[model samples]
Target chain A: MPGFAANKVENILDEGIEKGGAKLDNKQIEDVIKSVLDTETGERLKIYVDTCVHCGLCSDACHHFLSMGRDPKYSPAGKVKRTLGEIFRKKGKVSPEFIKSASIIASTECNVCRRCSMYCPFGIDVAYMMKVVRRICHKLGVTALYIQDTAHSHSVTMNQMWVKEDEWVDTLQWQEEEAQAEFPKLRIPLEKEGAEIMYSVIAPEPKFQAQLIYQAAIIMNTAGIDWTMPATPGWDNSDMAMYTGDFEIMGRLKRSHFDTAARLKVKKIVMGECGHAFRSVYDVGNRWLGWKRPPVPIIHALEFYYDLLKAGKIKIREKYKKSVTLHDPCNVIRGGGLADKSRYVVNALCDNFIEMHPNREHNYCCNAGGGVINCGPPFKNKRMVSNKVKADQLIATGAEVLLSPCHNCYSGLEDIIGHYKINMEIKFISDIIYEVMEKPA
Target chain B: MHDLYNFVRGPLAWTAFFIFIAGSLYRIIKMFVMIKKKESFVFTFWSWKYSLRSIMHWLIPFGTVNMRMHPFMTIVTFIFHICLIIVPFFLFSHNVLWDESWNISCWSIPDPVADIMTIIVVLCIIFFLVRRLKEPEVRFLSTASDYFLLAIVALPFLTGFIAYHQWSSYQFWLILHILTGEIMLMAIPFTRLSHMLFAPFTRGYAGSEFGGVCHSRDW
Candidate 1:
């Protein structure tokens, strides 16, 4: 067995231990564990725990294991054994130190990517197991500082980036004005009641990548789609809280998002290119909020672009001339099942499309989603090292431009490419579509 | 000794069968009943078709998903499970016992073919053991129970092979084989061996979730 090497960097768990350890006694820990294991988890958890044979078939499916030189600790099954299995074996009599370690293992180590679930012969959702560990950690108040802060932002600002209400509206107006250079009367219509689509985006778009909003406005205007962006807080759809195991805040964020759409009375929600945000609305948050699905239909930008291109509303003037490859965002491709539609949109807009090996749903995660990157600057080195497999995959494609639709994937790919010194430019799907699509004369 | 052997071969066997069936059914029911049902938003026309396809994709030996990722293990596991089921149920000796006990018999594999399958199963168990010992990742996840399960699985076949070859006291070895077989049957619902009973449901449910809930392609 590989021993846990003491790293020089101050571990994230120290803070969790200091804060949660003072607040929680052993009895409190046991109470939390008993409640979660007994009430929150159901037969699915029981069955998965009982059925895993320790076959270790899922080892290769994880990028962490691959990138970390096949270290056993990084293996998906091993992570579960160390955390959830240990908890079950101990029956909740674990110490503060153990809980701190478990919290770190659950929050920072595993991305909860669900790739391992694909490889499991018994189809055990190991990500669900990690989520259970995270839930326990959340109850113990041991979540990572950066991600917990992001979750706090979600609670207070209804956005991941803490964009204020006025700043959000101002950013939209600025993007709309910039986009009017192409179509002079283009508008990012705000809260247009009974619009055909309510276009939502993550806070990072307005805060950092406002040009994406500009491009989206151009596409919506040129295609003449009846869409509206909300001026208020609910427009940001990304949910770091969902990743941080703060289901209460996640539920609130989802309710606010859906309520905004309901108030606007849009037929459906069309969100920007963000994978985790798509998962939040379409699956996790909706389930938490007691809806079988989103109250209104939710379509991702990949699907939205596919629809527009298929309907001949968005016509291409020229094919994207650069040799490009598509990185399938895990949530949208595997979790949401938009792989085929995403490919269709890419093939329609790009002249030369080179596919990464193991493309589509089988593609590796960018190591940024699931709030791994949101754990933020303190863990950047760890993130880069863990993404060496993805770096190699990108390099092997030999494509000049990598088009990843998800914002997290884009940021992660940028980090890995820079770290590994790979010569590649990362672009989003809309970037190419906006470039190639015919503009109104 | 005779009474104990008779009990082990007769009432004990029936007890194991009942426990395996009842325990498995209880587990399956508990799983379904405990999890609250949420609404499904599977609106695709191909939902059921894809669910069935996903199940088949994993079910078929060296299926598309397994072939790409785990061709060697898949082949060995497929063969091992087939022999594990077929040899126990359809061997001529087993059917002869059934005929003697219950006035019922079924078609049997030729003795030579059955013998070859038993050997294959023993080899596969050895392979699994070696894998657990050699692979750091596998070893890290494995516990004493895992090795014990493998040993129990291999016990009946090993003792039965020795008895068939008349290498020692056949009567002693025969009793041991029957006792080990019954022990394995009883262990099925309690141990990781529960996978034999639970795999179909777990794998199928995973398929349905991906196909019907996530609307994702299986392979």
Candidate 2:
């Protein structure tokens, strides 16, 4: 009920205006738009803006709307109508005060979840619309501190969490050591040339969830697959910069990631289950660098695991026996077309599965995704409320375990599940598989 | 008075017919052209099938997703849409035009059923309008355009109801109904109501094909 209230709208708007109440000179607004419009990316942004018809069909597709108790102000169409529409109507002459409000709507509110675009009659991608809004905010230096902090970390350290070079290798070694306790001969196989796979993960693996790295090592080593994780900066695949709309730093982060793989001379990159990172490496980053496709093919862990099972590289000792539901992370399921593989992986690993009613692309978002959680505790209460639909969906599944295939999905789902006290365990696919996979001779 | 009503109705009916035909076709065709312009020209029917399944979940019961989350509202909205769709196509006035245009005729609805269905649709519209105004979340979402569209739609039904009751001169009410109907037809292609035509294709394209790539395409 705390999250279901709409009373905060007026207060949020008023406080936002007051915080950024300084009137902008015409010259400032003119200068900001001029700087952005001068680039080739600006041309694409302009075309996208010109195409929208402002149909409100996308309103219901947003979880924020449902989570905010069906507030239209939280709708994707409404967000655009408030920010980009205003800016476009005013011919890019918006003041700094207006930009501040636009920043909150873009950064903290919309999750770039693309659900609204599905409901958009014209297929106008409102996710892209929000990203462009964030881009403007990024340029105006109005980004959320926590998310932007990650982006800044990416810029300086070439990883979202400021994971240092030595610390990355040390974490891998530590994980390998923990994994070796399971299989003494197991090696993490760092910098191994011509390896069949170059495994990558987001910076958080080293910074927070190193056990995932440990679990993956056991799976890879036990399965006897030829894989190597890089001992360098690009080793971290997660890019909060992509979410912050800092394409400059996003490209740099992606370049480091791909470069790490290419430098290792691996056949391909098999990345961990982080949706945005997958999008950055395989789509946005590649596009930013002017490649139609990733120069080196990048496979999501879903696809990689699916391939591993299909190829009989590993046999299942037993299927996980929890009644589990799958949480679809937007980037992989919708943006990258990996829904089938995700399902394949889930089915391969889980025994008793209760499919979430609106499973796959129609699945509700875990509010912590899109770097919303990265915005920090200041917005956590709001973030928790914004995920009400997701909580309801999970509760409806009546499953004891939730198997999210992507890292961001894991984080978001974990937060939502905890907030609701739904008595469900959240985990990655690799953890379950590692527990049950039969070791090769 | 009859002659004046005849003049107004005849021209307005023709205008409504042409607008409905031209505007709907133009909007549908624009969608096709846009799809053709995407990187790959091929249309994947398999993905389209998946999308169709999801959309049909709203209509057909095929072990599809549940609408239980907002059960009451979903049902109400569903009924409202069905009436809006069926009445426009199968009501007496539309059926008369159908006979004239194609020389194909269908049976008219029974009087009681027709009256109930019309009344239900009118009531649903009013209920929706009231909800939009009374709920703060809905109120924040409602635009002047939303209210204006509702008024435009309510006009034809209100005038027709008055004509049915014979409270106002039948000729004048019928003429007013015909005029409001014409305006709604013209506006349909340009407004959010266009989702009626485009929702299927949009869902299909994003849901099925794009579904494979990302963990969820809800973005």
Candidate 3:
């Protein structure tokens, strides 16, 4: 009852916000805010702030505003006006309480999904603005606890989940041993220099979902692709620091990940089904490190699966029978542009494929990403309430299974489906692909 | 009274245009310089194909999902913009002034049609003002500057309408129209009206990212 009651109420008391709030004096907050606004932001921020007429045309594009009974503050323009707009108006002379709410608004309220950007006539990216507020929050040391811990992990160990070096190698060997049951000769290659493909994944795969690694190994072996995963800290391609506003840690994590891949001398890094990690490595991280593109070319799993299926490297033995729908992750579909390819793989693996309305780039965010879920348990119910639009989108599909290719989307959709009691089971695309693909005999 | 009217419609009008054109160029070049200093990579990703594609979509009424969804706003916005630009440039009286001033006149709409367009613009401004006040989502984002900007935009039209229709104090309305028009023109570069200048560039950058980099259509 208490657990249910907590879900009914919003998370008003968070240790990270409260503790960070306690230490932040008005002057400190003001100085940090001023420093970020002047130096850290670029032409993009300057243009966006000047161009947004506050026409409120983007009101419908945001999932949070729509789901929260059309709350005015949830509107993307309103959120910016209250937080960053206030900071700008006052010339960074805002209070600690204001910083606390701004942190909550920036970190938990927005997914920075870039969905709203598409709707603006000028294509004003409020997500970029929210991230600016987040950068200010991170500087103020008021980032939500769980996500901050993840950033701290990235700084300390170069991975999000803090998987130890031995634990990582152990997990790979363990998955390799588990997967060898199907093919006696199959191996999850670890650190083979000059391997054509370096298969990279988020830390969560090794930390909690080892079976996905097992599944990936089976696919790689079946396709006869020569791939190697690093045994060191760089194996994790996810960077929570990118979302937590700690760009310094994000730059470090990205550099290490690329270095590990380059050290292997792989032709390309085949990133696993993790959207945010792919974003960090391919888009945001590279830009921060002064590269227009990733140092090592990285392709997301959605596109990787498409290539495998299209090339006849992986053949299907039998298609999945259950009627399934696809949840397009924002980072991949919108950010990475793997929309058609994802459908290509899904249709290849499943007999019955149903398309969710507003599919592809227009898909609503899972509400778990952009460090929203990384803000952790305290904000679970808040997200559940905010993602009612997503729940409705899923429920309308009336599918038996939801196939999400991105790991963040999978977990986020799981929470939505369970919270709404939508009578749909969620599975990764790899799960369905592994089930139906022809294996080596 | 005659001298004030001549001064407002002549020298003040030139001053207003001077500030509008020079200030806009200054703002644009300043932004480019800032980009060069901080984030020059903006130059690396600009795609003319993507930029044109995005601008075209937004230009066409109901071409985007948001525009299509809010049919009333879309129609009002498109009509408002068309009338705002068309009437001022091609009105018969304005063209007559150009002919008198410089022996140059291209085309002019009949005064009756111009009158209808002017009234339509006034109604559209009212609709926007009412929406700003009535819609809570919009109201929350609205600032004093927003309302002030709206009034400044409407002033030239209102005064022009009165002067054209030969309402009370025609000389006063004529002088006021030029003064208000000058104020709005000069405000364009300094205030949110600069969006008219920045929209193309911002939309181009976003379109470049979405199309060239993300391989997706922005609109």
What is each candidate's DockQ, to 2 decimals?
0.58, 0.19, 0.80
Q: Write the per-residue lDDT of candidate 1 for residues A1-441, one digit (tens) a residue.
A: 333322422264345445876677788888899988887777777788899999988898888888888889988998999898988999988877778788777766788878887888877889989999989988889777788888889999999988999999999999888878768989999989999999999999999899999999999998999999898888989999888788999999999999999999999999999999999999889888878778989999999999999999999999999899999988998899998999899999999999998878789889988888887776777788877899999999999999999988899889999999999999999999888999998
Model 3: per-residue Cα lDDT over B1-219, one tens digit each: 999987997899899999999999999998899998887888988899998998999999888888889999999999999999999999988898899999997699998999999999999999999999999999999899999999999999999999988869999998999899999999999999999899999999899999888989888
The per-residue C-alpha lDDT of model 3 at residue B5 equals 86
TM-scores of the models, in the given order?
0.95, 0.76, 0.98
In order, the Cα lDDT scores of the candidates are 0.86, 0.74, 0.90
Give interface RMSD, per candidate: 3.2, 6.2, 1.0
DockQ (0 to 1) for model 1: 0.58
lDDT of 2 at B155: 75
Candidate 1 chain A: 10-residue stretch with minimal lDDT: A1-10
Pitting candidate 1 against candidate 2, the one with the higher lDDT is 1
Best by lDDT: 3
Query: Of 1 and 3, which scores higher on TM-score?
Result: 3
Give the best candidate by DockQ. 3
Span of 10 residues, lowest total lDDT, candidate 3 chain A: A2-11
Docking class of 1: medium
Off by over 4 Å in 2: A1-95, A114-126, A164-184, A231-233, A251-267, A282-297, A306-312, A315-330, A333-364, A384-405, A411-427, A432-441, B1-68, B71-117, B161-167, B208-219
Candidate 3 deviant stretches above 4 angstroms: A1-11
A74 in model 3: Cα distance from truth in Å? 0.5
- Docking category for candidate 3? medium
